[model samples]
Target: MYRESLKKSLYDKEAVIDVHTHVGMSPRFFRQYGYPYALSVEDLVIRMDMLGIDYAVTFPFVDSAFYVNNTGSSKIETTTEYCNFPFELENRNMLNEVNEIFPEHAHKILPFLMFDPSRETEKQADFMEEISEKYPVFGIKTASTYIQAFVNDVEGKGRPILEFARRKNLPIIFHSSVHPEDPWASATDIVDLAERNPDVRICIAHSARFLEPVLQKADGLKNCFVDFSAFIIHCKLAVQNSPGIAIEDFRFRADYSDPLSVMVKLAQTYPDTMLWGSDTPFNYWIQKYYTGDGKLVEDRLECGYREETEILHALPEALKAKVAYKNNLRFLFGQDI
Candidate 1:
């Protein structure tokens, strides 16, 4: 029944499934900044309803109490000013709470759990295995940068986590960056891991902030996929057109990437691996985009993801639909529809 019902949302329909949305507040928010606003699961449901989004693959905030942002990375300075990095409110049980309210809503919200594998590698794996079986977890996320892991390798620091994923049929979404000193996981590291575990599905999160090294590594690995979740062409255009849009959110450091040009090339060359994901509520903000003359216009996360059709003028309807919906369902879920 669920699979059949899902067809109504897809089957070449222009349905969108945002795979990178977080709900609820993280721990340590009050300590870093007083009176912080969080994007609750309820807020996400309303946004999806208003935008006609078909489904959102959601996750819990990282329980980052053990980790702090003293890395002095440029990305850290910008985001940490407004954000406290996800704190220690994350675990498998937290995700279960979100699904308790899933069925009452119109849109389908698939939830995933976040973990830091470095604490007790073996225990973390066991906990993941248990909850994955007990709950309806679609996948697992490794915010390596947030978790402070070196890479996505089984032999390296994340061995226990990677070993668990290698055996299980579950997919892993790894936070990747191309920077030499990413302070998180690197794209090169993910590529190496994917080569060793060909059967395991891996998503190189955020396109490694548009690092070509990842794409080069993904060339031979069929199970590897690239995500345009947090940053996309439309997001860049929105900032460029609006004078004071930076005031809305500089959390995402799309400093060098031309997401529009890069997206077009990736969609054409690696169409199969390309997937759409909204780093929601993070990206889903009420940003006032002003014209050249400073005339304000109402544009928000509701309109940003549709830039391929509305703004970029490069992606045809068929290709646009593929990037937005088909690519993800087919590749990730192994479903043709």
Candidate 2:
């Protein structure tokens, strides 16, 4: 009885199941800052524990070569010759490390296998299938910057990978940052895929940002949903555009051009279709500025996660429960949660 009560309390209306996280590194670009890999799953867990987040679907930031080893060297290096060193956050080995580190929490964490679909073809599909069969993985992750980060590339190399996911009954989460530089997993690209592969469950990271076309797509497509990772669920931040005319400008307030107000409105509008994600570490932007020559320690919990939890707590209990854990649980486990 106590266990049941505890489960009920933890899975309360405010309970959050973060759908996007990196247990190893930020996407490649952020790695240049000389910060140690924030993808440390242990560190992520501590942060999640502080924030009351029960589970997270982790995707390694991927570029084409994250999964390969040198021809002769038995030691696996985390980089590729085609791309620069340090590779993207989507390293497959990092997924292995995370699973190894938390065997018990492994099921709660869904690690995405990273692949450069254009380059890795059959080998990629084979590895993904093997891992899915051997371990508990949520799905696969692909980056849009692959084409943008390289030259002479057309469209995402993710189609073949998605095909493998379809065969395996897995979901693929794509990062659809509102920012324009993010090219590979744009809302249009993902929408096209979702339309084509109706069985594949696609979670668009960052609530499809200013991608109205993508947001509208979620309304009709049952398999599509948005992840609120970078958006401000807590405080108001400067928006790129006031009127939100363009997709990039839509960052602050594309829905109604009101950043602060849109979160609740959107949540109410699309309750079951939304998933809460801290998108932590990257979310440290909330504390980017400090008023001292010395370090000031703060809670460091992503404010967006906190705010979203509060907002979710305010919802009708049933709806809050549905969005907080049941929604993803249903999508992931059918009826377990």
Candidate 3:
């Protein structure tokens, strides 16, 4: 059924935009976790074509080859002296590569400039402004946790970039987390930021790590959106860790073994604010799961582009249309395509 639906959508030339994806290299992931380091425009386009994705909003890998120590650790070490601008190289490379190498398919690839607020905030914003004029920069992407900054720090470290986005009318996608220790980019902080800057469109990446706080208040803020990239993995982890715990006013039990149930319920509840994203390359890796026999099992999460497409295809026609593409158009372009 999903394949049939996908084929029809493809034949109809219906737009299927993935709102969250990464490109470029991540030495940290490669060195520490043995994940694939390089993801180029060609690589992404091949996967996007295979998945029948019409367009994808992509940005450079947040963890560029700058940091020395693990970012997840208490102490972060960086080769700051040698590389003052964090994502400058990667962003430039992405824009140039798309424009020069993939000129014919450049329209299919929408690149967002990655921002690092902790280092030369004003300079980085200046660079972004310059690039927006030169290239088709769709929006801005920032991970507060990577930079050890606060998303709601409007008057302090976060102000310059926030101000830039507002002035340029650019949407910002933040890498939010549900981890207790990583509160810098929590859904609460992102919501606060969205409330404060009502004009700037803000997307809480990864569905605020699938927490309930953002889902509870998403509809109230017109400029705020959420993407469920890597949601199945997070949901599985949450269920495994806290099977019976309620997700803070979510009005649903987290005890379900199937993560798709939670995803469907949330999407049905907040269809307007939902957007589809794959978090590709990373999603291709193997994942561990506990089987019914209580034995730990290692396998892929079985929720990649094809699986996600199936889930979306299973939705009611109206809701499926919105989550699969319409919401992305509204969020990124301020209109439906």
Clashes of each: 5, 9, 0
TM-score of each candidate? 0.71, 0.70, 0.84
Instruction: Identify the leading candidate in terms of TM-score.
Output: 3
Give the TM-score comparing model 3 with the true structure, all chains together.
0.84
Between prediction 1 and prediction 3, the one with superior lDDT is: 3
The segments of candidate 3 whose C-alpha lies over 4 angstroms from its true place after superposition are 1-13, 70-73, 80-82, 242-256, 284-305
**Per-residue lDDT over 142-223 for candidate 1, one digit per residue giving the tens place of the 0 to 100 score:** 7665444555434565577777776765677877654333435767677777787788888887754555556656755788
Q: Please give the lDDT score for candidate 3.
A: 0.70
lDDT, ranked from best to worst: 3, 1, 2
Q: Which residue pairs in candidate 1 collide?
A: 63-87, 63-88, 64-87, 64-88, 145-184
lDDT of 1 at 200: 81
Q: Which candidate leads in lDDT?
A: 3
> Which wins on TM-score, candidate 2 or candidate 3?
3
Candidate 3 residue 284 Cα shift, in angstroms, is: 4.8
Error of 3 at 194 (Å): 0.3
